[model samples]
Target: MIARARLIGVVGFLIAGATGLISSTQTWLLVSLSDGAAEPLAVAGASAVVLLAPLSLTALALGAALSIVGRILRPVFGVIGAVLGIALAILTAPIAIQAPVSAVSAEVAAVTGIRGESAIAELVAGITATTWPAITLVAAVLMAAAGIWVLATARLWPEGGRRYQSERAERRRSGGPLDAIDSWDDLSRGGDPTT
Candidate 1:
């Protein structure tokens, strides 16, 4: 169960982060102009939520770090992940529910050279949300659940391996004789291997 929990937490965060990053580059809303332009203006997730890409990157980093960090840091990372998930949800939920005129202001400005909230609102005939926002919301929920899972099962996870420890530390712990590799390591560190 411990191993399964660890796997779940790691995999869940990874998938959620990847999906969120991908969705951030996708269209989240379509804005129709009151003037009846041939095509509607597209508002990307990144424009709608500027923090989306950064938050997703953080989630990816957190997932990678969680796999190798010791028990002490697990809960800390878990808390960060939970907060990130909630933040993402908070930023995305409003746009998903009803995209405000400000959400498409950038696209409108770029296309029609119109600026300001009122100006963009005047040009926008309707705002329709795309599927990307829904997908991002689901990913946010999964990320939060994975974080909570980590917090609950951190103590049950196995202790981190000592593979990253220096050979001298390993030898001291095991009381083993120094090997050729240890001699090379000592030499590389400006120590007298003969000593």
Candidate 2:
């Protein structure tokens, strides 16, 4: 159960991050111009929330880091992941709730050369949200849950792998003949395997 918790947390974080990245590439909103002179402009999740890509990338990195970090750092990364999840939710919630015209204002301006919030609002007849925003929201929730899982189970996790073991432990394993790779590893740890 202990190891399962660790694996579950890591997998959850990774899946959530990947989901977020995928959603960012997808269209979050379709904006129909009031003039009806042009097709609705599609606004990608990244455009809806400028930080979406960066935050998703951060979550991916945090997930990778959590897999190998020592017990002491596990909770730290957990907290960071939770905070990131919350921030992501905050950024997307407004768009999900309101589907505000400003969400696609920049795209509108790019297409029609019109600027200013009020002007763009006038140009936008309606904003229709795609499923991507909801997917992102689910990802955010998963990320936070994974973070909390890590924090709760961090203490129960086993110590890190061989590389994280103590120098004394490595030095003691010198009974067998050392291969080239093993000799190099020992040398790097400031120990001569020849003894």
Candidate 3:
């Protein structure tokens, strides 16, 4: 059970790491492609780190939850939550980060008559300007919240013997042996196979 949860958690972490990198890179790519494209401030420090932070945290949380819960808890909700949260994060990161970046760009453009990624700047302005993007932002925030809730629910959800058995089987096939670990009887008998 613990083995299965660990496996799922590790896979979740890997997926989160990979996707986080891609999204973070894309954020920079979007920024770089903007008018002037004059490297954004602290590209490595701010952009990459900020973007990757959520994914890493989410992954860690999921892994920890799964491991703690063992096979009793499934990661399906975590997966869904992560997918939605990641999508919302990816969508809104630019909105959140770029909006400020755009403000700076606008000021710079106003002063120097140089536009770096004017299109992106305009988008930033448009996003931050008024009701439209604000509404979208709110929705994105709601979605992220829902995703978090989903993850939490997944963590707290209970499991039946069937779920435990399947998860244990999965673990046995992958990393550990089936017989090495005791079944429900072991739990009742107060035996610890992992020890």
TM-score of each: 0.82, 0.83, 0.33
Instruction: Give the per-residue lDDT digits (tens) of candidate 3, residues 5-68.
Output: 3444445444544444444443232233234545433222124234354654554465455545
lDDT of each: 0.88, 0.86, 0.46
Clashes of 2: 0
Candidate No. with top TM-score? 2
Error of 3 at 21 (Å): 6.3
Put the candidates in lDDT order, highest first: 1, 2, 3
> Where does the lowest 10-residue lDDT sum fall in candidate 2?
162-171
Worst 10 residues of 1 by lDDT: 159-168
Candidate number that wins on TM-score, 1 or 2: 2
**Tens-digit lDDT track of model 1 for 1-195:** 876888889888898899999999999999899987989888899998999999999999999999888889999988988898999999888888888887788888888988888978888999999989989999998899889999999899866464546656978578687888887988999998785
